[model samples]
Target: PGGAASNKTYVIYSDNAFPPYEFLDQSTNTYVGIDMDILAAVAKDQGFQYEVKNEGFDASMGAVQAGQADAMIAGMTITDARRETFDFSEPYFEDGQILVVKKDSDAKDLSDLKGKQIAVKTSTQGAAYAESKKDEYDLKLVYYEDSPTMYTALKNGTDDACFEDRMVIQYTIDSENLDLKTVGEVLNPGDYGFAVKKGTNPELIEMFNKGLANIKANGEYDKILEKYGYQS
Candidate 1:
């Protein structure tokens, strides 16, 4: 059996407003996205109970770091820096960051972003990559708690450009009909994983990985990705 059929419940924390990964479905008043569906399917397949917290990304990280959450699956990238604080599961997804500008804008890359504020979600690899090139590109970085806010900043006059996951930005642009265009080459290619506080929740990790494997074999994993419009 993948899971031990524990009656005990686990707590999970995730970013609330990240699209194609996690978001509030206002019509149904339910949380739905790639991350949420993956977690649900994995838990059911593993025969475990869990409760999800829809805190924003910044707060979710804090909750997990403080041991308030057993695991987190917030489209979170796996990185060596985060590994120091969290033990991550096997990589579930691969992605890369890219720069975005408003449609009709002349900015094509970081070079064109000189003196412009670039939007970045707090504590993300995108933010880190933007910072790494800020001086070289002559760019200023502004942080946002969620993707929508960051996109809105670019839509308005608050920000000139932004750095975000390529597919995520593409998803938003297509779904919301945003007049945003991704520019420049992709940056910081990486993998996404579920994470637990370092050295803790080994059983949860074991069951999760087992369930994940089962789902992949049974096509549930690909179905979830399709549900969120991700090409499996």
Candidate 2:
């Protein structure tokens, strides 16, 4: 078991809501997802014990910076802005931001959303992307703390559409039977990576990178992603 102490133990921080990446199984009272599985595999291959703890995304990053957590395995995008704050391992997955709107809505693309209300989670890559286009589209950006609340704002007619990762929005639409559909092509093709506090564990980061490369080379990576319905 991984925990906060001992040289053999590595603390991992992740939010419990990003499906296919990390989420709680209420029935089993345990965290399970592609992220968890990959971490477990990496730990086994690298001969280290790791435990994952649920924490908000930004908080997790902060924990790593503060030396409270050894690393973070959240579904964090590798943005240039983020690179200035922490070091990221080689990307383990690639994803992109997509638009989600109620079925039958008038909004078809960013152009169609001129003067429209849009919802996005604050501080996310999606939000940054939206913010960049806010002026061009004449959009009113509504920021939420998390994905669930942003979806809620759209469902309750508080916003015209929500922007987030395609996989996450797709999972919610299917699981909740939401009257929502993804629109247009994905806007930003981004890579997700494990984050470590700057200058703390080069050795551990090297080990994780090696493990990740092994998984991809050996086909375990694709198999795990396929199990979660991720095409890429």
Candidate 3:
């Protein structure tokens, strides 16, 4: 578990549109984001190489589970349920969920969203958090394959609100000038981890952990976060 396989270029799957975490840079037409930078930095530090696929998060999860991808580094939460199927590395980032709505919408919080359509990216922690309160709030959920589409639904009045990562939605709102605002307190605060299928690639996890530690110690981790305009 201490060293990676020599000359093996691991296949890593990741979200295609999870901005700040993972997203396409249109100007260069290449993938670039905090997660991408961090992974590259860590791999360089640990003397390993990988190829990342910018598939959606759900697809990434499925790919890893099906043994099509060696690992994943999307902005995936480290949940106990997830631990059952995937082994995760030490946490790399902390975040929480927030409810977002059109800026002029009257909904001020979860209580005001009763029976309203709530958009969610499928199979995300944000989706799970909304599911837990669906009954209590009488919420109707609308699932999308990715965040940008879910946000589009909310902005165009197709959905009344959406639950998303606090940092992610905020960045999208600011960068894209989307007419959306957060409405509720943060929920399900947790850390993001790199993951691989459980009981497989223990050495990869070991390399990731060691590389993450080294990057954090040598300041590359902080630089990566700051490059994305996120405070480390």
- Model 3: worst 10 consecutive residues (lDDT sum): 1-10
RMSD of 1: 1.2
- Per-residue lDDT of candidate 2, residues 131-224 (tens digit): 9999999999998877778888988899998888988888878877988899999988899999898787777788889888887888888888
Number of the candidate with higher lDDT, 1 or 2? 1
RMSD of each: 1.2, 2.9, 1.6
Reference-based TM-score of each model: 0.96, 0.90, 0.97
- Residue 140 in model 3: shift from native, Å? 1.4
Give the clashing residue pairs of candidate 3, or none: none
In TM-score terms, candidate 1 sits at: 0.96
- Give per-residue CA lDDT, model 3, range 89-108, as digits (tens): 99999999998989998888
Candidate 1 lDDT over 1-232, as tens digits, reads 4577888899999998888898889899999998999899999998999999999888888898999988899989999999999999988898999889999899877877787899999999889998899889788899999989999999997999888898888888998999899987888889999999999999888888999999999999999988787679
Q: Sort every candidate by lDDT, greatest first.
A: 3, 1, 2
Give the whole-model CA lDDT for all candidates, comma-separated: 0.89, 0.84, 0.92
Clashing pairs in 2: none
In model 3, which runs have C-alpha deviations exceeding 4 angstroms? 1-5
